[model samples]
Target: MSRRARVLPGFSLSLGVAVLTLSLVVLLPLSALFFRTAELGWARFTQVVTSGWVAAAVRFTLGASLAAATLDVFIGLLIAWVLGRYTFPFARVLDAVIDLPFALPTAVTGIALSTLYADNGWIGGALADLGFRYPWPAWRGFDHGGWPIAWTVYDRIALAPLGVVLAMCFVGLPFVVRTLQPVIEDLSRDVEESAATLGAGRFRIFRSIVLPELAPALLTGFALALARGLGEYGSVIFISGNLPATEIASQVIVKMIEVNETGNYADATAVAVLLLGASFALLLVINLIQRAAVRRGAPG
Candidate 1:
């Protein structure tokens, strides 16, 4: 038999291109972050990372990201299930529309969300009328109107921590929905039918069988959403008001360089290094859990 010509580059050429691309696009920029941090020396780097403002920003960013990812798991799964299993008018359009966030500019998303959630905006006005006003004073650690902690927390929905969560959810929704949709579509109906035939209730089957099968995909989606939320800036910036020691996000580290009185870049990069390390560690744990779930669900 005659040998057929290859349609693509050989392994050596392909590997070279891959490495070059990775170096240019990912490695070099990430290395710059570390290089800048190293210039600060150990003491200065630690001080920057341990600053009160940085701590507050870290807390707000991580808290909002976790909350948004948790919500996305439930909401995304429901949406994916409906789209994957049901037939309805404009269902395809709805599915496509879930990706609007991915396509829309982040600045535009920020502006729109800020407009919708601002005190004088349509949605914001109705929410404020319903007594959902943000507790600005409480956010600054003052007792406003003797409000309870719970109510104060609830009131901080717009231009506060909750606003950051909302923006995170808006940006992260597509990740969860897109991840889960395929896994949901690939699920075997026969397995569900067999469970039903065995007298298993809908909830029972869902909890016992469906959930286990979907766990890995769900975890993957959660990781993606959480990562996206953690790094989010533009959308969150507008809605959160970026108040220092209140609703500031981790991404504000970059802004620190721009706005710092001494024009120090090292402080910003030190914060970036810390954020990167924490994010990588968390992602590693999540990925391990996902892999374990996948292995557990696999047939021996």
Candidate 2:
């Protein structure tokens, strides 16, 4: 009989602890959600998920998340590079500033954004002066100023979605920055110097050499940002104007819960199931694509 070398004692005990923790914290709750959702029946489940409002909320949430994540990648890269590569005044302060969103309460962020974008607020005032209006009309035929005004001011852009995007972007920025900072610091500047010595332009060197290395970390950050944006409720609820079609999926879930307290538990669980599935699917796809890209970039 072969004798096994023991790396550490109490392996069985450790495994038991881990199993217990998983069961109590993650598995149990997720199982409950699944169990509750199962009670809805396939037809009701489909109806809840396939409703037009649900579809619209999903589209809006995903679209906004994608947009925010895309923006985060570039901005995060810049911020990380600045922090990792250069010494500047207030460097530490700037580094700390990047984490403000993490420290801020989401509800506070939402209220602050809403205030800044409301009709009488600073940003809103300037926008209004530039032909935008606040309390934007509810419907098409409200008549802006009587005599059927051709180009109503309030008919212009609304900032609620923009506020949500901004809030999410602020909160999500640090994820990308933190992920990329180490990778960027580890990069060999010698490679870029060699490329430049070989007559490559600045843009060419960055496009060819820098971006590929950064892609994986960037994608990871994008996935994090996208995930956070999808589940975000407090930061989005107040600033999103809480309007149907415009409200996020989380907000919709809250409203559903409020509609019928008795069914709230089951309906809320159902919505959670849907959101969970979507989040899982999106992260899986992004990860797979990133892995494929990384493999393709590797030497054969």
Candidate 3:
């Protein structure tokens, strides 16, 4: 067929727009980071990024992000499966609500999480009745070993690194769920039915037939969630109590700039450059994986 349809502008025009958008939205800020960081000599940059506090923050940030992203993979797979494969009352509503974290402002999310998990809050109070609590002080106690314990579901998660993981899980959940939903929906039940007919148990069928197909999407979602978790700030600051001990890498940068009278912006940029490099590495790998997945006719 001669002169088949073209829905959009010519390639040159489209490419120009894409480059402009990318430069303004992403490249310019990143360039500023490097430029500012260059002001700090290599020795100074290394000292700032490799300091004891910065090291600790980096370790905790990576650890918490990994833990939260791993948890999200399991939880998201289960939810996406249910939402995509089943019909139930308010199913659509539940599906819609899965993205609530994305739609809500991070500050609002911070406030909500802090309130819900506070000692006197609903979940916290119920957990208290069940003997789960955090030891706060002489106030809000249940007479345990002469120490005053406050109501919290976790033994020590409230205002700790574990709380960072919790906040990350909340904000990053939608990525995993949304990523896997399409894959779940596209899954052919015929293979599963045949496996069942061939005497495969539910678990066996799922493990052998479904998991492999979902694995790629799971990885992509995990990477995405991990990236978001690493960069998280507002919600995590609230849930994690902003303790110096529980500070993440982003907080380290913030403190470096804001904590001092002189405000070490160059030092902070040095640390940020490292983080940005790492996050970009992760995203690059994810993009390659996504492209490979698409080539293999798999849902992303």
Candidate 4:
């Protein structure tokens, strides 16, 4: 039997440092939140969660985040393709621009989008010429009928739902592109060439080969974007009109703590816990899908 060597490097030391960092930075804060929330009895916590407005807000937040993440996935893929495949002039400029949302303050993004989508705003005027009306209710402060129904796309596209989505796409496009860009660049073009030689169409080659390879990364990007949009507050608040049932997950938690006297810290903590649970569940599902994809990719 071979004797164990003592020459191994500082793996234990590095791991200890990492654990300490995570505990101080992440676990401690999260534990505090849960501990504070525990002060709310189960009945109160249940009431906070099951409240009609809270329910609606949850639905809207999840729905908008999902829609935004989905849209980001496609646009991000396109951008990634352009960045990786085509070398147009100013490509580097475009590359840098994609990361702007990441660096820009969320409040700044909210203000900018609110201004752009306002009734008399420049972009809003053009869209209005195309027959767009404000989508939110008047109480929400956005002029209703801002965009015509055609521009609405989905039935719920109006309201802050769509605005939140737009903001999310702006912030999230980079993650998707960055995740998939390397994979796309390293992909073997010979597969496409060989498939084309076999009389397969471009769409067929992409459907059969490209998409499968991209699926894992696509799911990863989707998860990241969805998580981000779920937690997004500043960029969505102004554009979303801050209406009840239209506000996002994080916004609801903040409002409960800040606005309503009846809202206890426990209630705020409960809602946050719910959001965290949802995010955790989503990540688990995405990871499972990724693992399945990897298994499928393995040689039989």
In terms of TM-score, which candidate is strongest?
A: 1
Question: Model 1: per-residue lDDT, tens digit, 47-88?
Answer: 887776787687667877888999999999999999999999
lDDT of all the models against the reference? 0.82, 0.80, 0.83, 0.80
Clashing residue pairs found in predicted model 4: 132-146, 132-147, 132-148, 133-145, 133-146, 133-147, 134-144, 134-145, 134-146
Candidate 2: residue 147 Cα off by (Å): 31
lDDT, candidate 2, 155-220, per-residue tens: 222345566677678778889898899998899999999999999999999999999998888889
lDDT by residue for model 3 over 1-300, one digit each (tens)? 698679988889999999999999999999998999998888988898878788768877887888899999999999999999999999989999999999999878878877877666677556656776443211232334544433333454557556678889999999999999999999999999999998999999888889878878888999999999989898888878878657899888888899779898888899889888888898898788867766775555
Angstrom error of the Cα, residue 98, model 4: value is 1.1
For model 2, the run of ten residues with the poorest summed lDDT: 148-157
Each prediction's number of clashing residue pairs: 0, 0, 0, 9
lDDT, model 2, position 169: 85
How does residue 89 of candidate 2 score in lDDT?
A: 97
| Candidate 4 local lDDT, 219-244, one digit each (tens) | 99999998887778888888877766
Which ranges of candidate 2 are over 4 A from the true structure? 1-11, 132-159
TM-score of model 2 relative to the true fold? 0.85
Candidate ordering by TM-score (highest first): 1, 4, 3, 2
Tell me which residue pairs clash in candidate 3: none
**lDDT value for model 3:** 0.83
**RMSD (Å) of each candidate, 1 decimal:** 3.7, 5.7, 7.0, 5.6
Give the poorly placed runs of model 1, Cα more than 4 Å off. 1-5, 133-151, 154-156, 260-262
TM-score for each prediction?
A: 0.90, 0.85, 0.86, 0.87
lDDT for 239 (candidate 4)? 80
Model 3, position 3, has a per-residue lDDT of: 85
